[model samples]
Target: MISAALTVEQRQRLVRVARGQEDGDLLIRGASVVQPATREVFEADVVIAEGRIAAFGPGYGAARVVGARGAFLAPGFMDGHVHIESSLLTPAGFARAVLPRGTTGIVAEPHELVNVVGAAGLGWMLDAGRSSGLRVWASAPSCVPASEFEQGGAAVGAADIAEMLALPSVLGLAEMMNYPGVLNADPGVWEVLEAGRRAGGFGAARRMDGHASGVGGRDLHAYAAAGLHSDHEATTPEEARERLRAGLWLMVREGSAARNLAALLPVLREGPRRAMLVSDDVSVDELLELGHLDRLLRMCVSGGLHPADAVALVTCNPAEYWGLHDYGLLAPGYHADCVLLKDLAGFEVLETFVGGQEARAGSSTPPLPGGGVDLGAGWSAATFDVPAHWPVMEVRPDQITTGMGAPGSGDTRLVVADRYGRAGPGQTAHSTCWTSGTGLTGGTLGISVLHDAHNAAFLGGTDADIRAAGAALEQLGGGVVVVAGGEVRASLPLPYAGLMTDADPHAAAAAVGQITAAVRALGCVLPYPVTTLSFLGLTVIPALKLTPRGLLDVGAWQMIGGADHN
Candidate 1:
């Protein structure tokens, strides 16, 4: 049958090929093709022409035929949600790493970069992703500054949303982390949503992603009712089920900070058609060690999920939710993207083909892959001050929270500063708090991954250590640095927006590994020290958090006395 997807010129050629009047471009012979939609498998010869499946049968002929040797041929995988910048590699380098793992498409959110450089930063990301020869579609950043309590480099408004949503490469609005705005009927929230709708009219689906973490009851309903269609923050099965019942697609994620696959995998048993898989955030080390979406797929399948169901979550389900009709399938007229797997149990990819060309998985180098991240001048400068009388932010090896402490209490100090020049030159917002019992008796750790905000966060047992650490980080452009006894102990330079490195994934991972070890030696027991410290700046998460503006009492949804030096 001639695929309706064929163009006028391609259709004529497809007709001739089916009639045996022309030879197809390529053919994979002797493979068990898994049709994810129908959950069926059939041994067949799949033929390709003009980068589309032209014919599929045992007798099909083609100019190039590769014997599959009974491998399992499945549709190329898709990452429903991801932040490519977290990998610390440029989009092209990131593609080189993950393409071998069978990821053909990605739905990315460049909010991290947007937080650092605003919309202009997103433009560079879009161009790099497109030039990589991978399908990299982004969602308009729904919360550029995230919220009022935090200070970011840029404040993206309704105008920004409308402009970004209209881009051909943009899928829709990204996860709106401001659930309070939706429930409270905030004008700013509505303005952004309305703008998204108007601009998304050019596409088939007007999608607004959600970030309602830890919210439940009627608030969940109201938030979903506000036109949000999908969520990746459902950490528990109860939350997943509730969101699913409320008509929100649940994206079960397993990333660097949190792993929700085990908690939410049960929802899949209920035949949750709306469920998808995502890695909202992942570190360079994690990507190189495990993989992208392929890692998540292995977990699902190994945990006893039906192979077809597991595959559907990454392929058909995400494609449908994102309205990407041309991808996520191995059918007629679809792009000739396929993954030849060694087996379903491990989902080990033998080869990945995109547009009928085999993707190459090449080696990478250190310091930079493709190109080095640009670090501006005056990076080594550090200007900060802490009041003598202020509440201390106590840090346990397990958690970080605020406490009341007196001078000479041996409490460690935590400080956050705006690094993006967002608040004018030399006018960066700064906040400091004291803390005890973190066990870091004599060193400082400074990093740029002030989560959600991508600011600069410094933690130290002594004032001098912190000062030295900050200077060291600035010298490296933007990265994590550990200092003790007035000397630099270890560091990792992430020159990309002070958040990510342009180094090779493996090399970046190694650098981060060294920093992790150094921070651990400085008395941090958290499994992911860099990630845990980065989250300190994320005010949206519960319990307690610190922003460049000041300390935030998340439960109360208000700023505390980190700014008020009483």
Candidate 2:
């Protein structure tokens, strides 16, 4: 997409085209333009000149014109918040998958990559986004390690944040997962928040995002008071209402494992002024099988939301929140980023235009560098040994949050190994525990896609199977793997930062499907088993979680028991 800002020459040309003094570069005729701001739809002709909307009416001259066939021409959809890494695809690969589905812009947070490879990872993503044919704005990752309780490959301090904030593409601070630190006025957290605030000294003030899962009342107020502008972790109408009332934008998230859009629809219906739809973490399979923002629009309209209102949520609403004044509208002088939809109810995108140019899948840019995994050489089957008395983390079906299980109970064994070699000389690099509700009876599932840290994690019925899975991951560099009876069953390699791949979307989705099916064959029942397993290592979420240090009691903000290792 071309830059939103117009040059002097471009602005002059647009004015001439609007007044019919000069021919426009392109003209879209017979389109039912959907006005998101006015909540109305009307038939008109759209004139595009110098990558900006020149006018809207009939009898305009242009170099080229295409018939819309009475299709709905709406402002292209924009994702309010997303982690590009969660798609298990590089920024380039991610853009290819979503651009054809009607998402022309996104506010991406590279925390997942930062957690695994630090500031360099963020740079790599920014460079990749430049040529992805998508308008990618970044929010500097606020919590690289997510919290002090977990160990990540690298740490991003206040200085690092200040440096990132100076970049033009970086809009604000990413999700503040360390809510406890913010509430207690932790010096480090305050310093980082202050850095974001200071960036606006020379320009518009930067914004901050929140990740307060299950936080409420005075705590939520305090979080908002610290200049946090939005939250995407609300899973219920009540939660959504509280965040909205607290003066924070509500990003109603619907992703592979956590489907909260259906439950939060009431809040959006009540008042969509501060609400926008976001895909917080979509997998390749979900992106290919269902769709992107288009899928959310279909669901919202089907659930009784007015078609215009639903379109506004992904268009005008997000554009306003992000201070993108020149986007999310079809009026003259706005950037001509639009989607040609077959109908409002279905929202089937026939063509997507970014800055008046047709967008196509795949990138022309070279792939970014990979190779972030760094497990030490002493790994073996003996690394899986753990006492039966260790606490077990219980996986909640279709949710990222976990629960506590009886010690030594359940058929599945869990292990979190530090892939960055961050463990000290004497401290064990791996932690062992048990888990229930995964439904795995006879195989091992190994993943390097663990949330926040991207560590190597394994779950299995036996130590030998776990060893087999680990070996396969080590050989593939980093990715997902399934093993049983000491043989590799299935795998998918994520070569970029051990969290994403540069493969085409279809190939990546097919690989994910094979891995999901393999896990199901071994008796696992979760709809997205690989995604569910990836979250087991997240230390910020509620109830129970596992980290390389040990099993974490999230509420208590400490390890549940003494470190369990071989």
Candidate 3:
């Protein structure tokens, strides 16, 4: 409700009365205030002046007044943790959709996109953040390249962390995802952590966040002990409780497929109280389908969590953890960000205000038009072509060695059988891709990633076809490519770190969708999930997998010879 028609004196009077000061510049009469301070609801006239709360009482009088007879006026919902990139909408689009859902602030990490464009990408975000009409605090991603396992766009080193910490809007280091480095006391990781501490020491206590997925027990203890202040990867109730007991602020998360919020409600209902709600990654479809943090609030109510408790989770808990002082609470010296809701269960929004101005005043919002998001293209398809070097002696024998594995591990051994029959990688009584005397996969597969396994092994009935895909993709550093029947089928150029495309998300997403349809056309079948060939080198999941280097016995978390892993 920003009006030049409303004089500064009026806004002043409203603030005075709303804040219990001498006189308000403007006052909103007959409204219910969801007091975060006491976790209770009360009805009163809210007054505002100069974009701040002036006063709030039944006998409120000001230059202007907004009648709020029936609505839940409370601190705007703040997503304690989120990734705008994961939202699949540009920041502007991201805000446009969520603001109407009563999301007033977000604590976000630009790490996902940062790996692709580096500092330039970050600068674009910082500038756009200023105009979003919402409070956005940047967390300098401690792991821009995520892990040394997979490649990414751009790089954020020690110096970059220091620089970001110095920025006013940057609220300390983003989650120090490199928990291994922290546990190992790596100099590079600490260098950045220490720098943020130094720069953010005075104004606000900037913190280094954490992402220890499987880290538990003493290591978890030592991790919390070392200053990895918060975590969001606890997948189970037990995991959440243990971390909380160990003193790590558990940012109990609820993302795409991982929903840990309901199970962890007891933690919120119980204990010494430092819990917050986070939407680590909400796709654009999900934003439209379900909602933003507002969805979280309603879920809490259904899960038997008190409405006031739900409000506290979204409001005060986050501000306290990240040391975000101003925007989370609705009080005298706080940022005037408030959401008018219909009820505790319905959680419908009637209006939203930031700094005492109505940014959104309806049920729905349009897609955000992100500023400065550059889609760097021009990476060619030739990059995904291959075979600079090959072990040509690859005999037409019982088994073949696919050349994608960990750097020091054995290659993918393709086993050929005397008979034209062998079970697939699974359902073989033993999960081996080989049949004792029969042929391996009836078709061919190309070399790509095996995720944490880091093996670039190709799949397919024929070795040559597999080589074609692997060779083509590897030659280009990294990107998704498909070749079949000895011909290039389709490809997407990820010039950034071989992981992400600099192209706008929409364009990149479209290209990816096309590639996926093409891959499906090739008739490849697996009992897993879909990804842009990015999770290839990962070794965490159990069973057979491949990487840039070779095959892996996931049960062992180690590389195995293509012929056999045992």
Candidate 4:
């Protein structure tokens, strides 16, 4: 719960403790230390004072001492890049779930909330992080609406980026999902990038994260030249190598929908210094069933990576990249954020400490603030009507990107409605399309958790089913719903921003599990149906996407009529 930086008085006390002139506050004794800086493992007793590591070695004395029982002690893990909103929990709720799994810190991008409520949402996230018991640093969302193709609750420009950079907790500009804009030298995009560069004078040089999926050759070089520091969308070793060669930090992502770790392992094996592990978007079910960065650590170790190297991927590597100097190390003068593990091979976390305090599950969550979801007037079951001969979007298993399908060739009908009522004058409130590969044979799926813009989306086999599911979601105040034969089968209410719930992590996760189960029972072939469904409305990623505007041909970068007039 203590700040990572030390005060003047705390520094003096730490010096006294290091000099053996004063007793440390606590001592973790008899442990094999995993030093990621040098990739070394050695035995030491870590001494903590003023919530910082004052010293570590034999003969260190403290008022309280706990035996490690020959455990492996490493610096607390950190997620290089993540969207906490993807977990469908409040910041406190997210901390409760990951703290026990050895994640003491993260570099989160609150773009999802910002997309729903604009810059005000960033303030809410910062407040929530202060009480979450996790050291949460943030990158101001650079792409507020993701792109002009989609309509978000608010639009952020250079001025907003400059103001956000002034906040101490906000490290820099978040993932610039609009790589095309950068390549085309859009004045707005350049202005935003310039804002981040200007913010560098505050302290550490401000960083700009990237999201260049399928970008390569000259385009990739142009993206890196725009001063983007890292990219998390690389799905193959070639892509990872290309980004690294372009002088960009490679963020290997393994989230609920995008599992790129195993595929990008070769790049990590060849050169891990410039690479870090990240969970771009993890679901509540995954967070509860599996661990956070700890799961990534185990995956790395099992995939032929040395334990120390794997630990560094989630620790020192990210710290150095994100300019978190006081973190990712268990050395003197650093914050005493440590994790005790039962073994190196399994990377089983026995205990997690943040600023020298043992992090307990569900101890840090506070009451969440309000104002995320706001549905427009006149929304009802009739809002989901789809015209015949509409453009179709094909969903691929285990990928967030989508491809174009033949018009009216799919059974599942897709509808996107603006929840915030922010559409321009003369613009329609909703758009209708079609989709294939959802594997839904006879039910309707409705969710307000649509990516970026967070519009209400409905996919169903029949008009009645779609209407029923849409109505159920509206009644629940925004969440996911499954309906069949005019009856609501299962639903999870996400009252906050229509993206997350303030409920406990376990309860929220249980609801998500139930929703997933219902979707699977409805004949959905995708492993993570809700997560996949949410991205269908995202206008940024690949070939084709849908929004309240209409069907978007992402490659063509233009909105096309969904109905096939031919």
Candidate 5:
């Protein structure tokens, strides 16, 4: 039923060979096969005729066959959860970057791209992905603009979810970011959740996954009972264990920024409840260097987890949890998707076979046709604006915090201001920028690209550093910058919409690494960086954050003004 993809003669021949009436189409003669479904290990012959596995065991015959003499055959990996936009690479370009590492399928959430360009942007990615070799599935964005605190390119209502649900590739709603609305039964929230549920329940029925980052215990139970099943926000082992006990399918994630995987490997061997692996917000550079889901497999092994189980995390576990029918195995009648690994420790991919064809051309990656879509157009190749005086605006005398925003005193009451409609669902919150920009005294300064809210708000002794950095951002369109002493100190041009660079992903990664040296040259106390990016706009992550708007109190869901309590 997969259309005229394969010729009739090919199908007949596949059927004949699978039934053993004739010789097989192609054969992987003598290689050790790891079957994740049955947890079986054996040396066998794997044969494929028409896009699906035709036969297995001692012998096979076909017109053309691959010789995988010293390799491990694994089902092409599936990244259970992801946000393709974070990479700053278009779908076509992202695929080109990851395929060589043996990732064949990805469950991507386009909420960020949707925010930047709306449904047309999502539609752009879906159409482009379909024609490519890799298979990409979508999850109807549950939170279009994410939250009210920031501005985006567009907003999607329930009607949009319903429309997206109709697509064959849509995989239910993305992580429901609005827990407050769900708790209060807000109509807008329910409208989108219900539409996605309808689509998920179509045909064989799918599930609406949850994104409750900080919600736990009774609240977690409330969310699970409300029909949201899976979550990737379980950052700690205790958090993940609780979700697992509550029957929520857990997706252990390890993207470029967030790395909560090391603490969760013990759960992999605890039982067979639904546990999946995800690359939630990977960039092209990380995907190119460390790989995708396969990266998790290697990490698991290094962390003392079973290699086969690690592979299972990417294959059978996710397919079963997400209800993907045509993928995740290499048995008779199953789609012919397999990855050949040279070893199990690092689990290096020697070759990847998809639908009876070798996905790679020789040892090198195949060239993308017409190359691929360029994402550099999202914003100009410039930096942002900086003021003359980096407002050290204060409400009290004792609050001079250097890094991220946090209230200095623990007792002063904050003025409940909702001047702008930037508060989340039922919460009243205050925002920065517009007011802080008003009263500015000129001087020299410094800045960091605060990962949580995109650009790092300027922290300065004088306004000149901030002004120069802002000028550089406007000139480069978007990227991280630091201005010091009224001149550009150091800058990294994120030409891909102020988020990523168009340079080779490897070079981009190396460029990002250069910051360590630059920061060492400056002597600061910012501990770690990539992890910092993960906490951006993440009201779910515990503790505090510095947003482009201001410092936010995640638990209270509001921005704490100067002199507010910690």
Candidate 6:
């Protein structure tokens, strides 16, 4: 269950405990706390009781005391924007992966799951993160299917938006990917926004996030004027600067696929107040190897930002931006969430305390149990037909392009099927120009990770290989699968709407490593093949994207090739 915030009577009790009138629950001594408000560090003893900070004073007696060994204590880091589904781990699993790395708070956007299972999926996400030590602040998904270019597994309307807005766990409306809808004043989009505005009447924060990539000038100003608060889609210094000037909190994304940290560092100098660091989407392997916000903090410091400023970006700045009033600080009456760091340069988290209690090292948080949503078998494979000259989806490091690779190289075939029966339980195949640039020489890859829609997408050199891979994914209950020589080579089962697995965090990371190795053996030479493949179905990004219905020219917001194609 979600822990409740401190009540008035509880606050009064904490104050009495601070005065040494009663023994507190916990205490930490011999540590230097990073004071973000003043950019100073001072030695102090901290006292905690009833899940909130009691005081910062000398000789505070408690039922239990832990020696800090002179380590630096800083407020726990917060990921400003992330999709729990993108981690390929259930909410509890993702929490286990990041909590030890000093990430105690997550501003999660469950739009990916909502696109597949509707409002029930969003409820699952909130409940999954409820019992974990990490605090989850979910945002109501503003776009259910993400866009009209593709069909969603389930349709959620303005009423659904209003219902989620009234939820205590939902912070505000998630990233409004429908920027064109806003620009054109679409009535449907306005209905969703209006519901969120009315949710403020129920005492929810009235924040609206943004997603406007490569959009600047008056268009950007208009988007901001429409009441969108922040964006994580900025990829360049220029884009970041423009958004910062436009009054958008720039969430500098450093995800597994989209690595924008190096390029967006300059924005920290331009406007540090409004700049926050976010992973946006990170995989299990990335979390284990590079860590969460702690990794971002180290990169920022190495890139010439002061260590304290880096801490503020992940801590105070994000907490303030999201209006999490009780967190991101160690001062009196704040939540007792703190991270003990071994050093500034490495950002090594020696210990992490959530609500005055230290989480055990390397232990997986309890998984939220659930079954896979059965997308009925109403699909036909014959809809996939390839023409000689079709559009190609070329994959590069951390990005994709449509029809941009070298020609006459025997382009790979793409088949998208509405496995969820969104379009009457049928599958459609359309040929896209693809190159061996991604290095898949002799096999097929199938996955239900088609972004936003969570449909079955298969890529292969031959139709037989594609069919084998597709069947393998169906057998595994919807997840990533590789088939070669008409045999299943590797797979990972994402039972939850084809997005997250209920596996333990460590086991899931290990399985992802095996899948990565298997893909590499088949000549798939991309840095993050799964992540890049997931984005292939995302119609929000620029240029071209392939949806379950057909290939879409995102810029024009229409299908490519012909009106009747696919």
lDDT of 3 by residue, 1-566 (tens): 11123466655555445545565555656667888668788887776656666556666566666777767788888888887765444566566778888988887787765655565555556665556556777788777655543333356798987777666667778887667778778898778768767776564446778878677888899888777778887867788888888877889787653467887877777733867899876555457657878888888888887788889888888888777666576676565688888888979998888877787423222222212211112111112121223221111211111123233232223321101012233211011232111122333343222222112333333445644554566555445555666666666554333333334444555654555555566553321112312233333322333332233554344555332211
Model 4, total clashes: 2
Name model 2 segments beyond 4 Å from true. 1-4, 202-204, 362-370, 381-391, 423-428
Task: Find the candidate with the highest lDDT and give its number.
Answer: 2
Cα error of candidate 5 at position 498, Å: 4.1
lDDT of 5 by residue, 1-566 (tens): 11135578877777888877786667887777888777766788888877888878775677776777857888888887887657655555566677778888888787755654456555655765665567777887778755544434367889987887777677777888878778778899888877876775544335787888778989999888878889988777789999988999999888766677887777766754589888887755567767887788888889876777778889988888777776798787677878888988888888876676776321222222211111122122222332222232222111111222222322111111111223344433322221121122322122222222233234322323444544565566555554455555556675433444445556655655554344444443233233233244344344343443454455666655431111
What does candidate 1's lDDT look like per residue over 507-534, in tens digits? 7788878877887787766566676677
Clash counts for the predictions, in order:
3, 0, 88, 2, 24, 7
- Superposed by TM-score, candidate 5 places the C-alpha of residue 224 at a distance from the truth, in angstroms, of 0.9
| CA RMSD of all predictions | 4.6, 1.8, 10.5, 2.6, 8.0, 2.9
lDDT for predicted candidate 6 compared with the true structure: 0.77
TM-score: which is higher, 2 or 3? 2
lDDT (Cα, tens digit) per residue for candidate 4, span 1-566: 32846678889999999998999999999999999888889998989999889988888899999899789999999997899999998888898899988999988899998887788777778877888888888989988788988777778888998898888788888999998899999898889989988999854458889999889999999889888988999988888999988889999999998899999988788855688999989998899898789999888888888888999999989999888888899898888889999998878889999888898544444444443433444443244555665567898878899988777687677777776655344332777777889888878888988888888888765767765666677678789888888898788898787888878889988888887788788888888888988898777798778887788888888887642211
Q: How far is candidate 1 from the true structure (C-alpha RMSD, Å)?
A: 4.6
lDDT of each: 0.75, 0.85, 0.58, 0.83, 0.60, 0.77
Q: Which wins on TM-score, candidate 3 or candidate 4? A: 4
Instruction: For candidate 3, give the lDDT.
Output: 0.58
* lDDT accuracy of residue 413 in candidate 1: 69
Order of the predicted models by lDDT, top scorer first: 2, 4, 6, 1, 5, 3
lDDT tens digits by residue: candidate 2, 1-566: 33947789879989999999999998999999999788899999999998889999989989999899899999999998998989998877898899889999998899988887788777777777877889888889988788887777788999999898877788888999999999999999889888888887874458788899989999999899988999999998899999999999999999987789999988877755888999989999999899999999999999888888999999989989888888899989988899999999888889999989898655654544555555555556245666676667888877788887788676678888888755455433787877899898888889999988888899875877776777788788899998988888788898777788888989999999998899899999888988888899898898888887777889888877655444
Using all chains and alpha carbons, the TM-scores for the candidates as numbered come to 0.89, 0.96, 0.70, 0.95, 0.79, 0.93
Locate the minimum summed-lDDT window of 10 residues in model 3: 373-382
Candidate 5 achieves a global lDDT of 0.60
